[model samples]
Target chain A: FFQISPAPSYANPGIMQETISVNDVKDAHKNWCNALLAISKAHSEGGLAKSKPLASEIIDAAYAYQFGPVAFKPTWAYGKKTFRTTKDGALSYFIGDNPKFNDPGFGIGSPGNKDYPNLKNRSPWVKCTPENFAIQIFGNTAIGMGWVHFEAADGYKSKVDKTLSYIRDDEGNLRITVHHSSTPYSW
Target chain B: FFQISPAPSYANPGIMQETISVNDVKDAHKNWCNALLAISKAHSEGGLAKSKPLASEIIDAAYAYQFGPVAFKPTWAYGKKTFRTTKDGALSYFIGDNPKFNDPGFGIGSPGNKDYPNLKNRSPWVKCTPENFAIQIFGNTAIGMGWVHFEAADGYKSKVDKTLSYIRDDEGNLRITVHHSSTPYSW
Candidate 1:
């Protein structure tokens, strides 16, 4: 006989709605970092052959998490005019045709090829070190804020603060509804 | 006799959860502008006695909308290291010791006294013109993005982009959860 799932308890309504655990949050962040590293390595190594898969994985995750969809426009604050609302726009910022602020000579696209359709060139993000991670969880909703130090392939490094807001789907998968990032101000 | 609210529809769970009408959103924005105008007028007219009540009204609305008792921190980004999380902090940004960027000669707090405890400065914001307002509502949560142009008492003008995220409380009152604002980048 097929096993029947336990009925949802009415005693605590919070229990019924809450599904994501601390582990889930941790895992998501870990996976994200891993993906970034992998993409960097792939771009430096085999170029498009290796990196495309990782980029595809990120796009898949974006869809699964409902980012850049109609409900969630994933506002990205790279610059005044470069506020990206779509997934493609975000991809463009990270590993697309956009020129890097620090080094305008070196663009932000794939490692070796700037014209590569799906994230060419190795815009190497060597490390993703996060500091002061503050996570707040409410009923089926959560927000994570942290300062991240990113080491680039060209020995360039910068610190940026990030705020990510989430909402759990009906099937209990936590999806990001808002993602905002900005470089720390310096006089 | 007591009237029970209708059961949530199984056909479309999203529709079932969405309770706010388009009118409610419009009214909220209108009231917000009105309150801002009132506060500016009160500050200019009578200082502490006049402006304190308007500030308290905003605070009460914040509480009613579930902003910053615990779950909501209401992170407001005015500038670098100028993130105001508390109600008092936000007020400080508007009409407190923080000097306005465009008009450095004139401060934001009480006109005659910078020591005015509760928003003493007659920092008259002559106009609050919002452009490109994009408001997205889902269920009990919403986000509004726009560009706001502020004209100071001395005809000094500055434009800042703003993002406001909101959530409806258990009592069906809309409250701001996140408010981020930054001046346009200048090369």
Candidate 2:
């Protein structure tokens, strides 16, 4: 027996239905990449104080956290921290410095220095590019999957497989409901 | 620089626009649950010979592997097997017994015996229930996130947090493009 009752229809008859186009999805990806770059730049210039607020704003603008908990499986998060459903968890994943999660701050990165000699040398990301292999649009919602290549200021390049599910909000803004990223499997 | 060129729209102007209701998403979930139960039953009644074909059919009918690589992250998979994009990988995840992937066969559990002395005792699942916490329907596409509970014949109960992103196919069938499952974080 199903324990969940079907939710009420989110559609409003009074509002005109606007179909989401492929360009819209691309634009959304661009916005996301730009936000990540901005956060990294902020962190490099003024540390967490500058980056944390920007990361928060980006999360608020990009994700569907307002509706409820988002399904966020970050690239490096593992074990108990694999899924980040809460806004605070999302923030910590982006900018880190949160003692509770012990995250390396994927966006900000950590430098290899005396304090953390074992940690990998990762500088703030300076370049971000999305290479979508498949994009399926279903009216107001869309799903895109492909590889996202990231480059840190130290010239280190990393790539991860990424999938993002988007739903158009009442104001025609596309918000991410599911974001899953993982490194490619190697034999 | 974005490396992806925007894909052409999939909408057909001649066809009448059909909005996907919340019930449709629930129905899709029900179909998925039923398929899992059927696979388990098949394995119990006739072993891998009987269950393998059924698993293959279910994978084809349910997943969007036709569109391209699906972003699938199974619950128990780890290391190089974490993400299953290829159809072969998906099949291996469901039925196991494939030496290439070295899967424990999540759907068809291993019994406590000499061959698998260290393996946990797990019987074929007999019941499946989905409790969706959030379902966001955007016309032809939908995303659902919740917990799915499964019960094996031995009365062992397992629950996993799941997220599924579905897009309505040309034939009016809901096909999953992104399926992510993980155990709830225990901190």
Candidate 3:
């Protein structure tokens, strides 16, 4: 037997009609970690030729670029290139080799040079672990802040303070609208 | 004549049932700027005892502390005190004078010493202007990135790179879920 009810009318328009939960935010973080590892693996196995498409796909699926400009601030980005709002800028930051932007390919890694001494011995990343210190959920949106640890194949380890805001997309998938990463500040 | 319609059901559950607009994000930024100026004015006229309650009210109205921890990284905050996730921490950053945290009362300004040379001659802020570079809208959530310039009563000026994420709350008010601010990175 089916009981039919009146069309649902929200009494409080300010309240989220479809709520996002804390578990949902955690799942989004897990998905992002897996995607990063995948990009690194693709880079190591096939180079930019192989990793570019995968990275593009991941960016399209994870970021809200189609919706509008994404607020992305990479850890090492400085000067005018600090904020990467366009999709192409995001691509350069993830895959590298773009002459326009002075990116060391943060996700893929670049050859060691005088300018990038730290990247010289680095290989593709082998691991990524997200330790979320705080998570806030509001309706279809959520924000997470914490530290993300990375281990390179060459055993080089690094960590960054990361803040991300996720929103549910048209297809019910969570997508990142804001991403800010930086090394922990010290005296 | 009365017409009866069936209950409204979302065909795409993943899509936002209620969408936020670009204008909404801009309005939120304006509200934030006004609140900052109000806090400064309150401090200039009365001091922390008078400004603290006003700051508290503004924080409660503008931020999503009621939802959960906010991902707030204030400019000039260093070491372990960088992120202010709790309402109390947020209050301290805005009104200052907390012994627990090493805040110089960023919003209210403190008497400067050898440790804070730059703050020595600084006075309460008299003006705040937001220049948004990018804005992204997703359903009931939006993210904005831009520069916020401040001018002190004594003619001192400063600016910071700011990124804020807003979500419509239970009362239909736009509230900040993520707030990250820092001095622009240079070579």
Candidate 4:
């Protein structure tokens, strides 16, 4: 009756892969943004330490995972309020004891203030929606982008152009390999 | 005697895949940046026409590719000086016949002055080097980041944080999937 369980559909692998990849990106993106909001909430309640492990879970080990080899260089290191140059430094700034925001250097510094690394402050990000979300899926790898709208706790509203690239680990989880965010430009 | 050529060495596919992906991204990035300089040169010598084809080749077809389906939304809209919101609008600003430099709006208008959209004016980019280049290779897809320094033909110099995400097509060609560039924030 069962003839070798139907060969697993390796035929049309490209099309199948694209479908899976797109869906994966969509799901991962939702989780990723939600995680940001969750971290903010946790920070507001208990402080940045509460969000450290959550942050680690979302980011790729290559970028910085305490349990993994530390190859420090975050994709989110841009703008005046940027993350630390090294993953450890960034983690420290976020959850550890360090208060040197706005370091004056090109590719080096903690552009974020010395307060809580909670992005939305005590205010929660009600909506982290993408204006023109675009995704490019390549097998188990993908990149996604769009102008992210962050509706903060208050009536405060802001948006940043966000881009992220990631790969699925062995366990089929999307780990953010690159993250870059910045406000739109104007003179 | 051949013995199936030792099974074609599929034993360490992960390691092999990483090496190939990293190399591919490096080559693509080099070509991509150099293309910017080349386009600038062409714009200076001829005009936007000279650079149009080059631009089309590097960018994802979704933005503007005559031979492919016209899917608006480019992977390379970054910073304050951006193109129009729509693809046709952006194409109009880029190689189109119109020239509306700065229209007042939050997410509308090209902050770039009416010129040959080659970025650095008539000045050739002598150097577009990265301060700290970081790359995360994910099979056929990848993302790269660094603070790029631009030295223009007029001796004007500036730096912008740049990030890009891309995937290799079936033909093994790299197409930029996302590009975001911004100046460092300051208070």
Candidate 5:
């Protein structure tokens, strides 16, 4: 279900043999995509009494300072290196090619990879407010979506959809796992 | 707000000099103890958020692997060493500590360092899972926690919580900044 680098000399290993398929696309996408979904589910599925802890947990994990530098993007530096981010601006990165300049959403592929990066040239940086997220969890699986109305440093603003997935470990216990995301576009 | 191992010397460079206050403890212990109520609001405020994409990005950043070795534990007679992930029959390390381990909750504290014995015995091991986490963020301060429940090497099972903290960067953004963890404990 995972890969390493494009290095020519890197050897192939079959440790994580579970491949992503229609059967597993849901599970394989667990940890990454599901966590996003779980948060939403935790809110909507439970009562205020129940959801409070869930909400607090979500807030604590997402906004905690412990995430430190590795969890952040130095947009200015990222722009210098990958031309994907801006300095004190909006988040920008597309999964496609030549997206419309005026388009509100971002792309998620080199024209086509997976999911719905329906636009181009913009970033899929979702402005996730605590209010916009929708979350759900299944046996050994979880999913979520948080909408962010953020404008990139370049001033590209849109209601971004942040998709998420989750999976359980070998013990058959599900956790926030996969996170698959694509910004919505109005082409 | 803090630095990592190998604490720096040279007086910390005194970025700013200011006076602080402290109080004595007066609580239910039948003695006088000091309670904290916002002694100094100057350091920085904690951060807050409902959901984050740090883990998602980490997963997306993870390279897919088709083939690789297990790099098994030590052994000379075994010849050609290969990688090995104890995915099979793996139980939680907290089993011995909490026999009633029925819940999917993570026990906080580092493994060793005299805090928790369950974790002390298992050095260099960290729990990994897919679950919701949260953090506190302020003007220039933050802290967080992430958890995922799973089975360990035997019949043991438990949840893993990876807690972290950090200070804001010059640009007023929080990065992974700093990471500290808890011992993998049972329910």
Candidate 6:
């Protein structure tokens, strides 16, 4: 019997043919972001936001697992401390805010755990990029773990092990939530 | 600049304190039965071959390349075939002759030209279990592309993109070898 979790590699854009084109990478990333955006949208609005809710649902699940379920609130910083609401009311942060989201042990060079206090204590999640290599996909889970290229407070470029987890609820959909990463100051 | 490839979740094994065991899966019947063993060792070769003939010498100097500079030569297979003196004998099927050897392909997958006719064939060399994943060190002559896992056949299991190239003088002394994969497969 096939396992329960769905395979992310074969999402809407899976490798049907044996040949892997460069576009496959970009498409997969787009699919991944789309998956996340769905969830992010749901957390912001009660209206049905399409299949994207899966991503939001997973995020809520992570919050349920980490902070209390109440913490599932959605917040996106577009820039440093400078934040504003969009037409749809999604909070976007443009200013660079501490990635810890307010975790007490903000930068402890560890894959943050619930024990870290609040999301603020968590490692900052970076917007996904191509440099982050896709490592493995197990069963229905596609695990993309890589060294997030970021600058250390000391002005040095540091790579941290950033992990993103994607999963689906009872309904068939793709979602990404639950991130664990470490930075230099994380210790 | 990220000089090092990010290690997998299983890299520090210490990162995740767990005692996980896996029951082996059945194998796919491949040519010469040598690729099977190559894949096996790859499973535990700590990523890349501990040592190998410098990819430069192997590609530019290996007399084997004198014909075409093959992409996916099994490391040991290259060593043995190059000697031909019956001194350092058969370590792989490609080195030893099976009816498949005469199949008009340069090696087992000689028609490999079909997949990678231009030295860009994703799979440059092949190996069996014990070596498990096929390693292809592609640098086009730089630090070298190391440890890439491509979805391989035999039931779509991800194969380690590991393969080595070697070069020997009148007397074999591993002229210039390099190791590319800094981490192991996550799955």
Whose lDDT is greatest here?
3
* CAPRI tier for the interface of model 3: acceptable
Clash count (model 1, backbone only): 9
lDDT of 2 at B36: 88
Query: Which pairs clash (backbone N, Cα, C closer than 3 Å) in model 2?
Result: none
* Backbone clash count for every predicted candidate, in the order shown: 9, 0, 4, 3, 106, 73
Model 6 residue A116 lDDT? Answer: 31
Q: Roughly what TM-score does model 4 have, to 2 decimal places?
A: 0.65
The alpha-carbon deviation from the true structure for residue A137 of candidate 2, after best TM-score superposition, in angstroms, is: 1.3
Candidate 4, residues B1-187: lDDT per residue as tens digits? 0112333547733322323266666766676557667656665566656655654443444232332222122223344434233444444434444444322211111223424244322345555665445676655555666666667666767667766555555555666556566666444
Candidate 1 local Cα displacement, residue A158, angstroms: 2.4
Per-residue error (Å), model 4, residue A168: 1.7
Q: What DockQ results do all the predictions give, each relative to the true complex?
A: 0.13, 0.10, 0.29, 0.23, 0.05, 0.02
Per-prediction interface RMSD?
7.5, 6.4, 2.7, 6.4, 12.5, 20.3
Regions more than 4 Å wrong, model 3: A1-20, A44-46, A110-123, A153-157, A169-172, B1-20, B109-119, B153-156, B169-172
Flag the better candidate by TM-score, 1 or 2.
1
- Name model 1 segments beyond 4 Å from true: A1-17, A21-33, A46-53, A63-81, A98-123, A131-138, A153-155, A185-187, B1-18, B21-33, B63-82, B97-123, B131-134, B185-187
Per-residue accuracy of model 1 over B123-169 as CA lDDT, tens digit each: 57666666534555556766555566667576656565555566677
Q: What is the lDDT of residue A156 in candidate 2?
A: 78
Residue-by-residue lDDT tens digits, candidate 2, B1-187? 0123355466623345566678888988888889989988898899899999999999999998987777777776655566687888889988887888877667785333414313555688888899876677756667777778888898878777677878788777888877877665332
Winner of 3 and 6 under TM-score: 3
The residue-by-residue lDDT of candidate 6 on A5-33, one tens digit each, is 44455444333222223343334445544
DockQ of 5: 0.05
TM-score of each: 0.66, 0.65, 0.77, 0.65, 0.20, 0.23
Q: How would you encode candidate 1's per-residue C-alpha lDDT over A1-187 as one tens digit per residue?
A: 1223466567733333355555565555555556667767776686655665556567556433343332222223324433445554545444443453221111132234433233233456777765534554555655555555667776667565555566667666556565555544332
Q: Candidate 2 residues A76-161, lDDT tens each? A: 67666667878888999998878888877878853334143135656888889997766767666777766678888888787766
Candidate 1 TM-score to native: 0.66
- The sequence of per-residue lDDT tens digits that candidate 5 reaches over residues A1-187 is 1232232222644342223333343433332223334433443355334434543454333321221111222111232322111111112221112233222212221222223334334333222232225566453335555654443334444444555444333222232323333456668
**Model 4 chain A weakest lDDT span, ten residues long:** A102-111
Fraction of native contacts under 8 Å reproduced by each candidate: 0.00, 0.09, 0.38, 0.22, 0.09, 0.00
